[model samples]
Target: MNLRVPTAWFLSGNRSDSNYTVGVNNTVVGFQESEDLRIAHDVITNSILVLIILGMGCGITLDQFKLHLRRPTGVAIGLLSQTVVLPFASFALAHSLGLETEAAVGMMVMGVTPCGMMSTVFSYWVDGDVSLSFTISILSTLLAFGTIPLNLLIYSGSWTDKQFVIPYSSILVLVGMTTMPLLLGIFIRWRLPKVASVILKIGSYAGILLVALSLVMLSVLYPFMYWASWKIYIAAISYPYISFMFGYVVSALFKMENFRRRTIALETGMQNFTLCFAILEASFSHVTSDVMSVFPLLYGVNVRTAGFVFVGIYKFMEKYGPKPVLTEEAHHLKHANNHRESFRLEDQQTSKGFLDSEAAEENGES
Candidate 1:
């Protein structure tokens, strides 16, 4: 009744020869004795990654970019929390928890990846700053090419025994996958708004389908025991909540409004897990890839659970709690409306007074 699962059962072909390695001198090496199924799997996964990026880009617009940039404080804080704080948090957690090499590296990868659309959706649910959420999502993704490699180089090396050269080619492919589709999506949004909407829907649904297929594949290939480790569960469950708290604290310390604070917190907590999965699958051996994949899978589930809990609490409070106070902008708008109404009444009285005086003069003269 041994529950421990071997990687060979999941991945076809011999595990020993399937290791894809880069030399210390940054040489790119091919997979030895690679099977066609593995190659096809890689291609499909990368394609799905591209589509997901495209869908994300489609959700953004130049207007959002300009709006957030005009007031850059919130955006700056968000990027700092995302690229700097989250990675540091993950690195610390992995080391603190004493995760093994694959899990540690997985945690690092999850940290460095950009925020996903789920953050935006969760922001909306929790009455967060949705505009700011969109801005952070797009900007973080655009900057991911540079930030991801830098973060990986800075943190991932320590977790592994081998020299982890920066994966320039894979990153370049990521850049192309991210940038080109993003720009195309933006252009479609600008030129053909209707078409872009369709693309967005298609991309989202297709991406979900592909990810579901991948999970099914993983479940079928890798047994339940592969994911039964206590370390993985602890790291996955705590990671998002820790990230959420850090994001809130950082934004609150900067004196951000509550909505924006919530937005940043969600953005920081929810990492783009699909992208992380794709990177690990491409970069590591089948065994390592399979092992690392567990972190994101578990993380994705737990993060969503945290999001739902937050949303539920928010709804409960909104329903039963005290009436919410007006925000600064709303207060100003209310004051402006009241002032305008007073001016309108004064103008009407003045006109009436002038007409009455003229009528009296005319009557007297008559």
Candidate 2:
């Protein structure tokens, strides 16, 4: 049964004027900015990117990455699903749903880009395998640089009212900007574990705060994608959820452990929107650019927000739920993290006591 119906039944929208506008006039969407403003937004976004990179650096542990590598089956399966399955599924959905030309291509790009950093938090919140989620997110992001072009070549051939090209030079810029930062963080941690540990502990909240500030300040500077239409939004919101559900449900069918399933679910759901958005921002010289604009603005925001809510709901039920599906690997990992956290607390207490005692002794002598 073809389930396609008036999308309005489930979603909200009007289908007119999906194009760029000008002077608060034509509904067509384009960047309306003085060169100076454009430069400012770029500088500000880059600044935020730097903070995210450093924050991720502080958080990443090479040892955790190693453990992820050790479980080749999980990692391999996840990479395969993320790199191959999700993109194809998204392509199919776009075709069947008759997603707008730009939107379809955008979905393809997003599907292949990556599981995101946010998935790690969602994984933890849901009692999922944080390790597996991180591994998939990193590996998938790396793979997209290669596979996105292939997706364009294969799936995009039919959508050819216009030609789409990804400049290798631009892609190289993106990879360098995104991954190099994370890798640099890894290096810093290795070179100075003590310093890195302190950074990692507070990095998440601090980093997010910085980006939020940057985004607000730059909102006027950067012309936001105008997606006031219903048709455009339908494509934006539905695509991510469809792809995510495909991964989430399919992973469960394999009867994988609950934690693994949950991790797979969230990893498939979230994506590195910042990276995809950057690619779009750089390459937004075509109709595909419109797709790029809409997807990240709509798809990324909705999915991550929904993902976080799901994570929170799961967190509330965590202790109340059935016993965990901690495979031996995850069980050992949980124990290790607990032990490390315990020792950290103990060390802090001991250090404080020693300081207090020394101060008391000095006072007595005085």
Candidate 3:
């Protein structure tokens, strides 16, 4: 395989020495990419991906799915954010930052991918609507077949060369792999609730493990020079929060409840970087894939960190924040309780008076 340095290296004025030394500001970073290492990474990561999707599938039920279909506003808004708003935001960010062709394409790819299971986890942690989160997650993953290619067709032209081909076949394979496990999980949930519960637990742990492993592998495999780039770092750190903000704002604008807004925000922000990795691996050159991979790795770390912070803040507020006022139903219930207590007190007083009068009458008769 011919190894061509990514255009990002040239744009940043960095050069590769004969020994593949990547340098910036007199700092040297070096790493060798072997086929075996790539194969190992792919196998491990893909397994984790399957487990994560399966776990998420187990969380869904036909009832919850049909309920969302009946009330489609929240789901529709979430889909809009995931499919439309996110890609446009990424494209604008890339252009405004004046990123190189490869890096820009990476941004768009991350944007267009479906929402990850981590968002459902985050929604649960933050007191968001977990059911809505699950609903959006499965729906977005199923719809990714069309949305991924459509977004790429619309946005890739501005960032990619004419020779760049959209890997429709690879995309189809990915969609199939993701959906089949998800459907299987749903089946398990429907037929064997106990087994689905176990799988859900396993999947949650696997998802956390996947994040840790990805970070570690990225640090070891990718050159330090890529991490040192301020442009990529800024883009990665900002992308999730920006996407999150957009989701919240749009949902709020549509008058969604707080829990639904929170769910949508997390779904919008925490994208399936695993899917992005698979796409890059299958579609791009090795060198370019390596270069673009850095963005998602950095993004995965930052998004998780920010999500934890948000969860912490939400928990704190929920525990110590101002109490919400009673609703009409609660108010009526409270009033009824008070009235019942008053009636009990009156009955006790009347019984006491009658007993006193009866005792006087007995004394007079004696």
Clashes of each: 0, 7, 0
Q: Across residues 1-366, which tens digit of lDDT does each residue of candidate 2 receive?
A: 011111121122333333422323423334444666556656765665555555455444555565456445566667777778877877787787776666666667676676766666556445466557767766776677677777666776655544445445644565566567667766775576566555554554544554455445433433253333455566666655665576667777766676777788777777666556555545555433543455555665567557756766677777677765556544543443234353234334434545666688689999
Model 1 C-alpha lDDT per residue in residues 1-366, reported as the tens digit of each score: 011223222222223424433332543333222255445665786687667556545544554455467567889988998899899999998888878777788789989988876675567456565557767877888788789878888988787644433344644454466567777776775676556556765665665565565555444433432433577778888988888888888889988877778888888898988678767766776566766666776787678778877778778987998866857532332232224343234334434545666688689999
lDDT of the candidates, in the order given: 0.66, 0.58, 0.71
Order of models, best lDDT first: 3, 1, 2
lDDT, candidate 1, at 348: 43
Residue 301 local lDDT, model 2: 57
TM-score of 2: 0.68
Per-residue lDDT tens digits for candidate 3, residues 16-97, read 6343454557555545556676578778978887887787666554554554665688899889889999999999998988
Give the runs in model 2 whose Cα sits over 4 Å from its true position.
1-63, 121-131, 177-195, 207-226, 254-257, 274-288, 323-366
Q: Pick the candidate with the highest TM-score.
A: 3
Query: Which number leads on lDDT?
Result: 3
Q: How displaced is residue 235 in candidate 1, in Å? A: 0.8
Clashes of 2: 7
Candidates' TM-scores? 0.63, 0.68, 0.74
